[model samples]
Target chain A: MTDGQETIKSSIWFEEAEADNPYAAASCYCSGYDVYGDLLGKVSWVQYLYLLFKLDLPDPQHARLLETLAVALANPGIRDHSVRAAMNAGVAGSTKASALMAAVAVGAGNLGGGREVYLCLDLWHHLGSDMEKWQHAISQPSQDERIDVWLPMEHFPGFDPNGVTCPRPVVQTLALLADIGSYQPLIWLRDHRSELEAATGYPLSMAGVAAAAFHALGFSSEQAEMLYLLLRLPGAAAHALEQEQHGWRQYPFFGTALKPMADADYQSLMKTTEAK
Target chain B: MMESTRNSLAYFDNHWPTNKGAWFPGEAVRYREMSLFDDFRDKSWMDLLIYGIRGTMPQPEVSRLMEQIWIICTSYPDPRLWNNRVAALAGTTRSTGALALGVATAVSEASIYGRRPDIIGCEFLISTCDQVAAGGELDVIVMEYLKKHRSIPGFGRPIISRDERIEPLLAVARELELDRGDHLALVKRIEDVLDRKRMRMKANISSYCAALLADLGFSPREFYNTVLLSFTGGIMPCYLDAVEKPEGVFFPLSCSKIQYQGAGIRRLENVKK
Candidate 1:
């Protein structure tokens, strides 16, 4: 089997095996239990139960654990919290939760963050214009068609961390990662940048970040895409949850309320924070 | 001697008659008149307090209430309830400044309905991106115009009597019995302002649509996001239509020719010693 397919299959198998044989109770025996059964059809609940039993883990508990892990892994803030919790849990001998936390931390920090960083470096390596050359070109005062206007800017050519441009944190992180010689995610970055820019009318910083993160994590382009999709799931969920929790419906006074200006005191407070 | 009529006409045209004629006898006498005008300057604070109290209570409370509603809607396991909640949120009323809140609620609704293990695979991603980009651009442009012109654009237009889009959504809210009365009051106030201005500017549909989403329980940030999401559906078809137009280019420019009346001197003449 291909490395990716093997990885996916093995991961699935491992999860099932772990669930069925929690505490290694049934390591020796247990067959006809597959987590990913019926390649083209619906997977049955019986199969799920069998897979859980084979793993030797309590069925409902394992399912709950997986769901929690999934949620934690998807959100960066939650993942960060999970990492701390995992470390504590490991110390406290909470093996199952610790193991889950470790897996999530690795997935989020090393795999996800690393790939994003690599992608940014790759783009910079390939498409970055030399500062001196850019300055010389700009100074020549010729209306050259080839001159890229953004080339001379202090930051990298296309990544804007602030939401004013794309507002995706991944892109900014990738740019920073590339500066430090992470992996090369630029191949995908260069290819997709123009398309993303045209599509969004904003720079493709997030995509670059995603590519870098994927590359660092040793994900192929296709795998990287899958990982990105996976990572974004929790964020979307969290946003939804927040919305639900807040019970915020549509603004009743929309179009009637004058736009608010930040109070001077608030502005001063912001300045104080910035200074600090 | 009598002057030629043509010559007199030419003189009259050229001179355009200066103020050489005599004024009427009473023209120089200036008359001063005084009229009583009520100045609300003393009661301004009271007026403001009353206005503020009336306007402030419903929206903030409604927005907070909607946030809870959004949670319940999304968290409910029933798909039918989820869809209904989403529709309800989309059809709710919101505070005037609750754009961000409204978008958050709508996006959450959309997210709940379109939930999968992965968000990148969601069909709404591109739509979300497009909407955000377009809305962001519009906001920037509007802000820039406000800076330049000292007024907000797209908020009030004279030609539109009432925002047509708001009524249906409000009707839905009434049907759903989610009407907080504050939204209605706010709408009326907006109308009053428009009438007073007499400039014909009326609230655009986006404002009410955004407000409705907000009233359903979206955060202000999410309200903006929802606007972007909603516009994405509209933008894709519009962009496609633009691309598929009969003309090869989406946009064409017409060049204008100007006639120059000048001396026919081809070269500069230099005086030498």
Candidate 2:
């Protein structure tokens, strides 16, 4: 506040004014780190990313864990909902921005998506490493204080309802990251996988794993969500471009999935409507 | 697997099944049990949309009122709206019409405003009506909702206290003779409580339309489905107007507009580089 009146300002970044023009920035700063002068070649993207969000540079271990999580999360595969959404846009000649937008829209869901990861992080934050608390919360999902935004956790967030068994990738990724950091929640989650699976009656998804890792790395649920969304876009972008090249005819169709209504069914339906 | 098997309408058994109808090119398209070419070719666009969601034709007046509701909301083409701004930006970037409209429409499903609150408002009216029918006191029902939610959806608005669209919308409903719904009556009574309790913060369009829709026997899911593209008509004009302008002209911000309150630049001498 200049004179006790607070002027709105961005806390994330600022640019030093050039000598000649006030409107231009000569040097850029992000969370207090000099972008070009201090960090450009010296720091890895992972460390830089950590500093940008957390406003402090990460230790090597933290950077390594985050970089591992980032690589594992980079591509969610062709069958993934977010990737398919981008692919659909690409095949139909949607703009490049549209392709990414499609991915983000589809990815922002409570089921095996960024929202699930965020919720899982919140769970970690609230009930850290307590098996009893985790079980109770998963069993009842303590009611949301406000009823306006998210749908109630239908089937515990982060665990895949449709999963038949714990996927090999989830197991492998958990093993890789769980050992790196002393984030009690991740280690606890890794050790108590069976108990959690038993409680929720489903397998741990990549979202659950990533949420645990991100939480351990000191990212908030919101930060984890934003990072999760952006980090997963590379795969979506590649798949969309591929699908666009392949064309709509080459794209897989679910047309056979649609069962045509019988004439008898049609007549019955119309008759029922008239009766109503 | 064991638990999901019990709830498996959508499952993986090397088959993806759909009860929602499909099209056979050159023959016809099937919408549930109705033939699009044979039964629905003569139907209005709104009729098709409503039928697609509800699986039955509404009465003529119900159809008229629903269309009128869409038309009433369509008068807003102002790009400054939260959802419409996305559309305007998309236009300024010269994005495709599909993406511009699609993204903006997606943005309209916001938490505090748009479809989320509208659905909540509708559900509140329906559930309250049900409770009152089941011997619950009206005052207790409303008071409990306020206590639980801390805020009521349809009873108040941001930026302005009263809703301007309510009167015009109610007038159309009256003209169509579709105004006298039980839900509508209860909603007004609930509004009386809110006006007295919440310092004259009157009910807005969401609760009003929600009450009306609930009165007309719309389930919350069905109401959501039908009004999915409710903002498209307004969003389209803003997008179209923006696309006709020079690139990035919709709302351009220069560097000076930013208030940089972040840390000052530091020297790199401490670094090991």
Candidate 3:
């Protein structure tokens, strides 16, 4: 028993010291999980996976990895089978990750969650350009001429170039993270800003704040992705809890039910109310 | 019939217009009487009886019978006091202006409520902003107002604008052909006014949309209500975003003069000694 304990302790100590253990990296990633959890909850797991790969894990344990994957899948209410397929495909590196991410994006519908993620990326893309110059370009006398130049400053008025959430805590976090020498997340933010912005109308600064906080706390891409799932899970949990507590079973066909009204019913209600 | 009466009572409770002494005594009396009937029909007789009997009734004899039979059902949480407070708080000239806009626009635009005109307008404005921001030369006047601390009307810090969804409604107006030309004219006129004033006060999307709804023959009241509904979509998301990403923690008391003055007094005493 003593020998077994000693061996286990040595293995644990060795893994901690190795700096390349994926599980250790993941644990490190989890520490800063709260940063973008809220925003990420609104995004697709596939995008989260993309970010995870960017975090550069060493050798992640199978169980820990699966737990992270399960959290992401279950949080969004994605079917278990689909999640398993995606996980398998993701491991195989068959661009199935992108397909899964796209599925999550489609599921988001027009609720503006996925779009917000894209907006964050867009804002991050133009962090270093002069704000005044961008403003000037957008406000130039020749409106037609100004349209040709896709300057970030001109495009996003009253937004900070470097500050996440524009003059908020995200900038501070980014500085702190940069000071600690974790440059990969910030670099990704800078590179993906445009595409994300075009996809989501929200500013990059908003998303960057969360990304910066996670990066500062040493979260790998996978952990960051998981953090987003965790953040969004609370909202869904709250809704579900509320539904359960209230015994609020939705009956769509019943006009008096607490469910959302159909267009015709809504119109009739409005008409009746107006007449009154 | 009873349900209609109840609904009418609820509606009155939610949206009873305040008395500004604009009507004659007879008119006021008639309005109050009408309200009583509406309330009586809406609430159950038992509910009314219980409320009337509460001992705090202003006049004992009058209150006794009133308390036993009359119940006032208010849409507000607390009818007697809260409704008055809300009314008092809402008694601003700006609210009157909003009322006036609603009335005038309603007379002009009759079809504002068809198929969620406000939502349609919002979608258009969003699409336009995207197109213009991408490469099209769509005139964005609010971008200028953001410069001067005075907001660009519909684009920033919403509460002051109240009817921020007007621009999108105007986009809807373009489709309905109710008052599209007039709506566009209003937008152009606002631009002209801003240019003349040199203050950069461009007409925001809200005003434009409101004008369009007016053109579509929606009553100003309906137009305002639709605008509120449309803007609620933006407001809800923004609130969620704000909650998820709080800007900063503000310490109101810490920054108060009491703390500073208290410290200064100690410093002064030390200097005297």
Candidate 4:
């Protein structure tokens, strides 16, 4: 190449002819796909999801566990933050898509939502690999007591010692499935329930259990929350639809009555503060 | 519910520790044993609201008026029944100030400006205060703003016929012997003119804050920032309340309870093509 042409090329751009790609289309070569063309027609959606997330197809047992876990967490009910947000949006005459987005926004802020789940998953991975950190976490007081400071990844209260409404069918089913699949995390949670409870004042939370399962399954921390959002979307949509059909502008909870500020009280309160 | 001393302490305790972790990182590190509003010992709410406005604090009367105004703002909508109750619930519709603000703040700087009507109202009032301070007539300035916008900022509120805070704020301002500042005088004059004109507008809490900020020589931006900082502590109790609920489910509803209005199910293939 001419010096002038080479200079222009170098200054403008450098072509990446041998750049590696993590995804591919219309080709046999792809992550864990000997034949992408065949897998497209043959693989189940759940199997494909597993491959996409794990970068490898799951065995039958692992596939069932992952599928069941997703199903169990899918639509927790109208009480769920995301579901109620969606329904409220729908009641306010928002479009279906807007309602769903509203629901996602609310859900994304909860303790089990994307941010907290990501934290819990991160802690799970950290605690799994590091014994010292695990020891510290177990020794810490219940999350409620130490409101002064908090780490995002803390509070996997699988069983809140103070009473947790663990959806009975789902939790029991997951535990049973975990046994059949021989997943160590689920088994560990089941076997060491009392010990873990003793270590941390709160029992293992639903999200904590899910985090442990995700960690054991080799899913990354970031993937854990995205996976949750995706699973919960349909549930939120269902609530939005229901709200559109039967709900009103307001929820059941009556609003707080505003106290008219009595002049006497205002004076007294001011005087009290001044006196203090 | 009557806010007992214990409940008040709980409200303060819930917010102070979590403030550093959740939102405002600028708060000084606080341990468990420290009292609520501990950082502002002997400092009244007015002092905190206008912290950076002037090197010297306002006259003692201004301080007292500001204190009364703060009390009026904080006293209403009981914290236990509202902030720590219904309004702060996670699924609370956008009707609640906290939920709406929560969503608005989530958007980056590109979208934060328009969500806060109180801030907008304060900004407009601050600008008007500038002109009045520059010797502009309150009637002419207000008329010009009303001609363009059909409503005056810092006056009138939705969901209520009268603002409860105005009279108490004025009473407190008068009691404190600081009722005659230029901004305050102009605001009262505007209220009188509006009343005579049959325009049902009354000064609200923002009006009081804006007057105090302007009298203290705060720039419009400083007024906005300072007022928001003052009230940001209020939203924390709602958040703490919501999180304490089971699964953090606030103000829950059963699916069958919802009323649907959309079109019934229609098959895609059944439609004429």
- Misplaced by over 4 Å in model 2 are A1-8, A16-27, A36-38, A141-152, A261-276, B1-11, B267-273
Winning model by lDDT: 2
lDDT of 3 by residue, A1-276 (tens): 123222221101111112553232212121123214232344245333433434221222322333333343244433222233333333333343233443343322112233333332333344433444333433451232111001122223323222222233434433443443435655444545454433333344433445343443345544544454334443243333333343324311222222212344333443454444
- Residue pairs clashing in model 2 are none
Greater-DockQ candidate between 1 and 4: 4
lDDT of candidate model 4 versus the reference: 0.55
lDDT of each: 0.35, 0.80, 0.34, 0.55
lDDT of 1 by residue, A1-276 (tens): 123222112212322224543333222222223223331133234323323333332234333332332333365553343333333434344334233434334433322333343344454444343434323432442231211111223323234322234444554454444443423443344445544444433354443454544444343444444444454444434433343343334212122112113344333333344344
RMSD of each: 29.5, 4.8, 27.9, 21.3
Query: What's the TM for model 2?
Result: 0.89
Please tell me what DockQ candidate 1 reaches: 0.01
- Tens digit of per-residue lDDT, candidate 4, span B121-217: 5566666777877888877877777887787656876557576767777777667666667776667778887887788888777767677656666
Taking all chains together, each candidate's TM-score versus the true structure is 0.25, 0.89, 0.23, 0.43
Best by DockQ: 2
Candidate 1, superposed: residue stretches over 4 Å from native: A1-82, A85-222, A225-276, B1-76, B79-209, B213-273
* TM of chain B, each: 0.34, 0.90, 0.30, 0.58
Docking class of 4: incorrect
lDDT of 4 by residue, A59-131 (tens): 7777777777777777868776678788887776676766866766666643556666666676676666454
lDDT of 1: 0.35
Give the runs in model 3 whose Cα sits over 4 Å from its true position: A1-119, A126-208, A211-235, A242-276, B1-212, B216-273
